[model samples]
Target: MTSTAKTPLPPAACATALDPTAEPFYLQVLQALDAAGVPYVVGGAFALAGLTGVERPTKDLDLFVRRADFDRLDAVLGDAGLRSELTFPHWLGKVYKGAFFIDFIFASANGLNPVDDGWFERAGRATILGHPVRTMSAEDMLWSKAFIMERERYDGADVAHVLRGCGAALDWHHLMDRAGPHWRVLLSHLVLFGYVYPDERDRIPAWVMHELLRKLHDEMLAPPPASGRIQGTLLSREQYLADLRHGAGDARLKPAGTMSAEEIAAWTAAIGEPHEK
Candidate 1:
């Protein structure tokens, strides 16, 4: 669908600005990514805000890139005067720029790789800070949040908000098809989040949380198991936390050289050039 397609907004999204300061910075980064020809689909809080029309102040920008292009991505960011803060050697993803705190996720270490290529292809277009950019599909955004919520990495309420707001706009069949095998996990998340009361959990409404839960139980779980393909391995949460602490002093985390006026101009000129064939 086109970017301008009328999609339902998330509930509890503020009509007024939530974080004016952070939004502008995010837009700049989006523009930088586009100019550098770096393909990305916006994720996390900013994406939640974009879909719901609610402004959620977030500290960093999250983007998804293919696994093969890490070095190319580093060069693109370098051209734009940003630098990697941490490269998870075991994980292909890296954290870039401390001040802005951008995280470039190559692929989920979890078994969510099926969504990767599709997300990049179907990314909806949007205007952030007056710059035209691509964003994750509302369905994909909800799935991402649902995945995180299931894993207990995020608050259940946040996932609920995203679901309630964007639920109406999602393509149920498409979501069910992609989320088919993970229905149990998704239902478990809904139960954990209190989106559905225990007795009433089986009845999914057209609403966001309910549909997601129902889709998980009804569609995803009904299918027979296929041969699963493992993606990259994931570090345990404890291991990841420890690595973050250990990498605290690494200067590689520091931002690369600041962009001079001339460099900024050149970088802007280079925006929209394709990064990969």
Candidate 2:
């Protein structure tokens, strides 16, 4: 709802596939971002398409950049005639060049995964719309998509596909650290990945499962939390408003994350707005 409005391209045009040609504006934006020397990795459907080899039309390109680079990114876009604005200062921004636009996302919709320098260090190369670009690693993509379980859109299948397509190459130890306090979300996706691709269950390393299982076993034995905080908001900010309104602790709040109440409110209010993350 807060984008620098443009005569946006239809979903059928300017797709983010490896060989798209319906729209040329996306390429221009990507070229500008690259020329600026600011670190970013392709994300959203294109990144998944790169990892899974399933091409599909995307409304906009997703460029994952760090918060520290927002100002520089905005300035660079402006110089190139691509109007940019911080759509949600907490996590997302948008750059518009007439009919085509791209998202400059710095954090997850749930305010969980914040883009960091390590992402570029671990990035894999890909060709999007014929432009050679870096992409989010399979582990980072899986980690970020694991929590996208809204009623309208769920990325569980994406997570499963990443595991099936590139699970063997994933650095499980690094992934474990990425999940950190959210290891259970990672484990759930892994369990389902094995279920979804029973023939490829061997793709998962044995020790990873053992470690997660031991953690689960220990937690199940421990006493339940007396506070009973409803952290489901961390997975879908729009779907869990009722619980938060009833005084449940929003995991997006501090001590848990860097998002503030005002930021959470802005992000929450932007739900259902067209062309959102």
Candidate 3:
């Protein structure tokens, strides 16, 4: 296991610059993960706040670990009294401390991107809950947050906030690669980010925009890839289920481009409730 060591936090009497009076339980959780030698990158609201200085009330801590490390994590944390469950097998796992919990995420709900060691390489250092931790990269955060278009939990705004904060500091090339087949999704967010923060538009590299725009232009000029393929689900898993199920089953709909029926079912099941379109 690759150790994710950072400068140890000072004693509890000292107030860290990030979050003073951090919850002791959260600190315990971080300590356990670290002591167990779990390689994880802190993510979610804590990470966003740490990196972008955007403080939001987060319900729980999010620990982003590689899928390959999950079993090891389970092995180590279980002895520390943190009960874990593969709650959402495709993308999420959970470590519970009674009412409070930590989210252990390895993949996107869409099953497109998975966490790897590269995530740690680009990670920033932070003192979360008064414990030294690695923060997820802005590029990976953008890629992960790009897919969250649910009715109740739209993360487009968060994506824009990251761009506003990281902007020129972001690794555009790596981000572009992370966007992959979903480059259009990234382009949409970047366009909207420009709209949301007009003055910061130049923060994004001109070449990045040019590449995305060129791709968009080519896509527009090109004929449809196939007939009857419902691309709607790619945007939102819940929004296009009707189109995928009841709408004319278009043979040309490339299952590879978007979530297949099985993936959709698993995602829906994983959430433990029906999603609002």
For TM-score, the strongest prediction is 2
lDDT of 1: 0.52
Q: In model 2, which regions exceed 4 Å deviation? A: 1-22
**Looking at candidate 1, what is the lDDT of residue 171?**
71
Weakest 10 consecutive residues of candidate 2 by summed lDDT: 5-14
Residue pairs with colliding backbones in model 2 are: none
Compared with the true structure, what per-residue lDDT tens digits does model 3 show for residues 1-277?
3323222112122122333333665787788888878889888877776556666666667888887888888877788877888765657888777666778888877666788889989988877644788888888888889878876679998788788777757788888987876788899998998798776677677889999999999999989866656655545666666776686453212455434556456666545363211
Residues 1-277, candidate 2, lDDT per residue (tens digit)?
2322222111222234442443577788778888988888988887877677656767778899998999998898889877899988878898876666788888887777899878999998877667888888888888888999898989899888788777767888999988887889989988998798776677777789999999999999999886656778888888889988887887888866668989898888878988776
Better of 1 and 3 by lDDT: 3
Count of clashes, each model: 8, 0, 1
Residue 154 deviation, candidate 3, in Å?
Answer: 1.1
Best by lDDT: 2
Whole-model Cα lDDT of every candidate shown, in order:
0.52, 0.80, 0.72
* Per-prediction TM-score to the true structure, in the order listed: 0.59, 0.89, 0.83
